[model samples]
Target chain A: MVSEADSDEALMELVKSRDQDAYARLLDRHMGSIYAYIYRMCQHHNDADDLTQETFLRLWSRAATWKSGQVQLTTWLHRIAHNVCVDTFRRRGPDDYAEIDPDTVAVTDDVPDDDRRRAVHNAIANLPERQRTALVLCQLHGWSNKDAAEVLSVSVDALESLVARARRTLKRELSAYQREICT
Target chain B: MTADEFADLLDCYGTDSVAWPSSLRNEAVRYAQVSDEGRRLLAKSIAFDAMLADSTHVPVAFRLRARILERIATNESPAWWSWITQSMWRPALLAILPLVLGFVIGDMTSELDGDSTDASMFLAFTDLENFVELNESTATDD
Candidate 1:
């Protein structure tokens, strides 16, 4: 019986041994963030759901392959989720990611009143795939540049460059909206 | 850090000084304070960061967690395989038992005196011939 107090590595050790309870606990610990990341990346609820499930399923099946100290569990999970989302994008083709209209973009009811946030969300959605991933991982998901770089399999400098370009684009796109909000 | 460097930091790390590389955070904060352009850039970065931080939170499907857990449950191996994996020593011991038995029999045979060994060897060969003869007789009868 693993307690909630167990570190992710400890739970993963048990998961490696086919411990369902430990696997369930790991799922509970990480499911939300992983789901949010997939949702943000793919921008479709159903696809995000399926991709998130696939990511965790891989975790369950590939638990033994995870080396404890080589990478943080969250970072490893993000890498898997990233790969799953990338595979989905490849299958769906680049044409599938149409521009997201701010008005039609689905968000929770709590944020409908914040036009600035919606605009920012739309701007992020419009970013090129790599830029969006870099920005989302660093800015929204709160991953450090190093960890985000590892997830993307890029150098830290390259990750920073991606994030810089993304921020510049967002700032340019949202300048008018920001001015309006200021007024 | 120069104002340009400070702005670059803002570009990569957003407006949060806490997220900036520790070695540069103090210099970046100092530049933002002393330079008008740095202040302007910092303010802009802060506003953008706030918008991003406040962006829509997409709720996971209410049943998604339960659905994943259920799928995992159904995907589990059969109980017997689960038992085998869970108690790996059982299979490992079973695997080595044959080799252990062979070694024990060889050890016993090696301990036999020379006369006793010859007699036992003769008895073994005779039993083998009898076994072959019985099989041949059975075939003739058939």
Candidate 2:
């Protein structure tokens, strides 16, 4: 059976030409993944929904400037989501939530798991902005390190270093959990 | 690589979105052979990465696919402005320019004609002086 990914390139071509049908088709195809990614990144349903809409608005507005093969349109959307999340972070201020334990906070869409997932997410949330972004792109999203690096505008080696540091910090923070669960 | 170095690398292994290099694979295998502890660390890292990979959660409301598509459809369609700004503006400017030039040229020519009329009247007085000089010379000659 034909897949959505195959048609995405064609839809993008239509989008570039301002073909509303194609753009609509593109949205239909990719909106779920886009929304999911944004939701995960923001961990706020309202913000994710709003940011997803904003992301598409930007995609539509910049459609004319979109050049195929520069980046996958999905990656482009993620980059937009990344910026929106960062903007939200700045607007909400550094004191958005000080002294909160990442381990205790639950940001699930449905049934709540224990604090393990919460801890992972908290570790993600507490990361320095770039490391958090890099971790989200690489770890949470399952994007190739190269693709994540491309989205972040960093060399692969630099990206590796960021991931290393982020992981080390997470390992330290969640070490207690690891000992309980793994060892 | 030492145990500490292997542990650090394992911690970083699954965290990056980038593909693991073949060289890294070799390193992992080499480390695995040198120390069972390293292999065990790699197993833990891989398990953690798998958990992250499996953590995608799409919201049910995100099925606003229809609405999203409709938004893209209605909003991005080529509109009146595209043609008005991109296609029509320059030609419209070109078309209006000659009419503006015609009005300007007409005003300038009218002013020049008025000035020419004044200069011609002044030249007519000079012609009268020449005629009077001719008559005085003829009377003297007679």
Candidate 3:
């Protein structure tokens, strides 16, 4: 009886042995966060879907290579997702990043909230890519600076600098949006 | 914590001291409570945290999760085959080794015995049916 109490490492040991049930449980446990992280990074529903799958597929294929305690499984998975997003971002033209990404296909409880969501989208999208990534990983996703830094392949100090700059940019952008809305 | 350190923590870890590294959390929270700058930064962090919490999280759609799981299941079968092909050599060699060792040891043991009945023992080197006929004829003569 594989319950939610099974540590990710335990599930992963089963996963390495090709236990589909265990893998499914792992997917159920993590798919939301992995998908959410990828979606927020790309702001495209289909791309996020594909990238999320790609991330898990990598997990399944590379299961044997995983070492316990070297890094947390979630951190490892997030790093894979990060790499997928970065590859995708690299393939896209720099000019493509300038425009507001279509509001994330994040399911909203209220239809009226779409406009505010788009405003948030534009605010995040307008920031420089690295800064935006640093913000998304640490601020929105609640990752520790060290883990987030590891994912970004940056020093913790550098990640801190990027997040500070990103926050300053997002604040200005959001304030501008608020002013425009009020006037 | 100094004002700069407090601000840095807020910048790097956002509003939640709970989410901050354990070593820094207590001091950072204490500083946030006592210092004006820390409080202001906490307010900003609070706003950001609220904004994030209120924002919609895009769940992995049901169909997408099913699709990925399905693919992984299908994908693993080939991997099992690949693993066998990649690792079978050692086992295969090990399987043949016992036979080779038996023949070598059988030859040495028979040589050590040096009995006239050794004719039967060396049967491996001779034609099997002829050896059988020779043994039958020798037995009849005896």
Name the candidate that leads on lDDT: 1
Q: Write the residue-wise lDDT of candidate 2 on B16-89 in tens digits.
A: 31445666666666777688887678766766665444443446654565566667666644566554544537
lDDT of 2 at A29: 70
| Model 2 spans with C-alpha error above 4 angstroms | A1-6, A102-112, B15-18, B50-58, B73-78, B83-142
Model 1 Cα lDDT, one tens digit per residue, A123-158 = 877788889899889988988899999999999999
Order candidates by lDDT, high to low: 1, 3, 2
Model 2 docking tier (incorrect/acceptable/medium/high): acceptable
Candidate 3, B54-94: lDDT as tens digits: 55356546588889988976766765564654354657867
1 against 3, candidate with superior lDDT: 1
Interface RMSD values for all candidates: 3.1, 3.0, 3.3
Better by DockQ, candidate 2 or 1? 2
Q: fnat, candidate 1? A: 0.52
What TM-score is obtained by chain A of candidate 3? Answer: 0.82
Quantify all predictions' global Cα lDDT against the true fold: 0.82, 0.70, 0.76
lDDT of 2 by residue, A1-183 (tens): 546554777787666666777777777777777787777766667777788888888887777556677778887877887888789889997787344474363333333344666666666667788887777776776677788888788898888788888877776776655554454
TM-score of 2: 0.72
Candidate 3 docking class:
acceptable
Error of 2 at A152 (Å): 1.0
